[model samples]
Target: MHHADLFGPVDAGLPEGLVYRPDFVTAAEEAALIDHVAALPFAPFQFHGFEGNRRTVSFGMEYKFDGSGLKQAEPFPGWLLPVRDHAAALAELKPEDFVHALIIEYAPGAGIGWHRDRPVFGDVVGVSLGAEAPLRFRLKEGSKWRRFTLPAEPRSAYLLRGPARTEWEHSLAPVSALRYSITLRTLRAA
Candidate 1:
């Protein structure tokens, strides 16, 4: 699959001052990755709905890093390898104890509620997989919402930092098929 650099820096539409890269993951990898994740145990990737409400839903796998943050022991295999390689590829970026978590969401009839990611984990990075889901960000004190339609292709990576990192609230829309995503974040030590 061909990777598309859909948007550049100036026009990166993020309410929280984040950047969007559509080509972060490829389509071929998306299929394989989903298959792999599906085979995994329900515990690591199960969707947990709180209360009796039908809307509240969340799914993800958390991985704790070693002293160097380079190696981690999570039941999900091959998950740590990519993070290690990514850390090596980027300059000025090192392995921190707070690495990241892989989250796959399923918003079948309706999408997620608007909310800002927890700051306790530091910067959040994500890759879109599965179906094409639109993400909208609400600007602070502004009526307009900056919306992004993320491709459900696999192997792509998106980085959120700076203004998009702190200010905006993000959520997805409903889709016919399952909605899947992989997010990476460094968890702060308690």
Candidate 2:
């Protein structure tokens, strides 16, 4: 099916500084990326003071979130240079701007909780492979919360900046099939 047909219209109500591009990669490219990810060793995601079901590894910069806060570990793997470049171009960000990548693999029953990316990170861009999942967003209002949902389809890419990156919190629901995401982020300036 055509990528446009798969994603349909972009919602006008989506928060500011959000970009969703479907078919960011061709089927062949997606397949190859999936294979590469499968070959890599993935450890259970350890963050926010607890372990999670999703398995994750990093490139460019490894991220560790102890109970207190997030920290950078080893340098990003050299093998991920191509992917980092591709993601940077797609997001209209400079290659040097992106200094970290967090590759996450989620099983059928796994989903991420609502939360903002660490403040130390700048713009965020992510490529989705293997499965389609709903990416939801929520923002606190006076006494309520406003919400929105976007489908993160296979081969698609999404970018979050400005308010979308800082003020709002995003999450994914339990996926029905295996899904892989390569999330790239720039280091926030001091």
Candidate 3:
């Protein structure tokens, strides 16, 4: 079942502004993207000098590992415009509004840890490619945690906004197969 819309009790029982669109890209598009992604030079994700297994290539703006803020990296590439349009539409924003883009390659046994996007970013739009994995989200309420997991399948796109973007922390538990994800983010208005 495709959970494609503004959030309120989705198939995964998530809350608030957690939109998803399965089949966001055609099979041909997915294949083309995977080929392009495989060619890009990626660096291991670093946080405080500790490197993560998954590698990434950032465009438009890159995050400063020191947590100071984002800095300009390579300019956004034109080849990704088609995919960005789908992601932006899911978030109800223009593609040009997104100022940061990331292409991540998750090798076997690789997955991202739990964390929310930086406050400097507004909405989080991500397109999953190449494999299936559980995209988990959690929130601390009182003394307990409320959690939900969405099956992030190939060709699917999801958006995190409002409470989902600010209040919940999401992560991709380690996966068995290779995978790729394209993330697009809009800068928070000054």
Candidate 4:
């Protein structure tokens, strides 16, 4: 694919600045991921606070993990070696165990509030699948917002690291259909 077609047009950066990768994941891979998750039982989204509180709300199903988090529901035997291991990437920078949160919603008009990943993690990774949704990122405490209108194509991934992870905030707009994201993060050492 041509460089321009792959990334499309370049857009202004967010307040903290951000990097954009249009084809983070291929369409075929995206479909497989969506199908896999769709087969799983839909449960209430779970939440874990920085203070060590764990809770589940009926409105959504969110999973929060610390250190020992795996990308999939069932662990793959030889799962995620250094080649694609996010934790390995983070280990280069900090010593804390990594944490992550994932939420899957099937119905339309469901959305998450505008918020930044807490300072607990050094960086954050967000992957979108099932249907296209518009993602907006704004500078923390700033009124201006930069939006990335991503197509709902399957297997799409976005990595927000460096200053973007540390200084900016992001959120998704309300939409119907199956939408889910796998988030990867690294916590600060105790």
Candidate 5:
């Protein structure tokens, strides 16, 4: 199928401001990116109160959530400029807008818990490689909950902005196989 057929308005009655584009990267690009990530030094993700099941290497401005808030780390590496530029173009965001990235590796059975990106960040964009996984979303409504799932296929990219960034929490279930993702974010204006 044509790549365009894979994209549409958010389904299942979810809020607006989400963009999912399949085949955002060609197969060749995917292979190169995977190889690049494989050569990087990956560290297990750890935070104040939680630890991630996946391994990650951050570039640009690394950010850590200190239980109550976000903390800044070293600047993103110069080597990441090319990938950042590509991701910004795919997400239709200006290059200057994306100031940070996290390259995460999900081994089989690795998955992230549900949570919102910190307020310090804006406009989350992610590129998926290696395998497909369901990106789940949930929002609390009084005593009930509303949920939705988006399949993130390899070579695809997704953008989360507006309501999709602020009003919902997102997560991935245990991955069935190896997968990698590059998540880019911009800092919110002071």
Candidate 6:
């Protein structure tokens, strides 16, 4: 059987509830955020018995993948209030609605695997900084899969909500250079 090349890369359209915006932050603002990130302490990301290559720090609420569950970290810092507000606006949510924040540092060649955000989280808003990486998405439909690659450019932001947030799984490709990202998540009400 011969496979059609057209079946591989789906350049047709993006998924629903997915919004991508380039140049979400100014150059000066990105630089300042990077400087602040550089000053903060970061710990190795821990998964279910594995240490991830990336370093991360969580604010508001930290979710433990070790089956331990969610725990509170520090409140959102004063410096991040404006950023949170902007991301919230893009996601059509209030800043207070985004109760969990994460700052991650990706070393060269470090990347995350395919996985969706936990069910406890409602929506995801992310800001990419310092460098660019491809954020890939996948959805399995029976025996077939649909995939899309999103370029997470520096100083850019994206919002994932509704079906995109629930039905699709997203991951990042390893970076060729050091990179930083900010993830703001809203919690689902019990």
Best by lDDT: 6
Local distance difference test, candidate 4: 0.49
User: Which candidate wins on TM-score?
Assistant: 6
The estimated TM-scores of all candidates read: 0.63, 0.87, 0.91, 0.59, 0.85, 0.94
Residue 24 of model 6: what lDDT?
A: 90
**lDDT digits (tens) for residues 19-116 of candidate 1:** 55555545665677677655544332223333211121122334222223233335425744554345324312554433555555564664667776
> lDDT-based ranking, best first?
6, 3, 2, 5, 1, 4
* Model 4: residue 92 alpha-carbon error in angstroms: 8.7
**Candidate 6 off by > 4 Å:** 1-7
The sequence of per-residue lDDT tens digits that candidate 5 reaches over residues 40-110 is: 89988978767878999887677765654444555666656766788788777788788778899999999
| Model 4 TM-score, all chains together | 0.59
| Model 2 spans > 4 angstroms off | 1-12, 67-79
Q: In candidate 3, residue 170 scores what lDDT?
A: 93
Q: lDDT tens string, model 6, 83-159?
A: 99999889888889999999999999999999989999998999999989999888887787787889899999999
1-190 in candidate 3: lDDT tens per residue? 4443333333347769898889989899999999999999999988888999999999999997876668999987778887778787788789899889999999999998889988899988999999999998888877766778889999999999989999999999898999999999999889
How far is 11's C-alpha from truth in model 2 (Å)? 8.0
2 or 3, greater by TM-score: 3
What's model 4's lDDT at 151? 44
Model 2 lDDT per residue over 13-125, tens place? 98898998899888988998899888878999987668898999887676667655445555666656666787788778787788888899999999999999988888999
Candidate 6 shows a clash count of 0
lDDT (CA) per prediction: 0.52, 0.85, 0.87, 0.49, 0.83, 0.90
The C-alpha stretches of model 1 lying farther than 4 A from their native spots are 1-16, 43-76, 83-92, 95-98, 142-156, 188-190
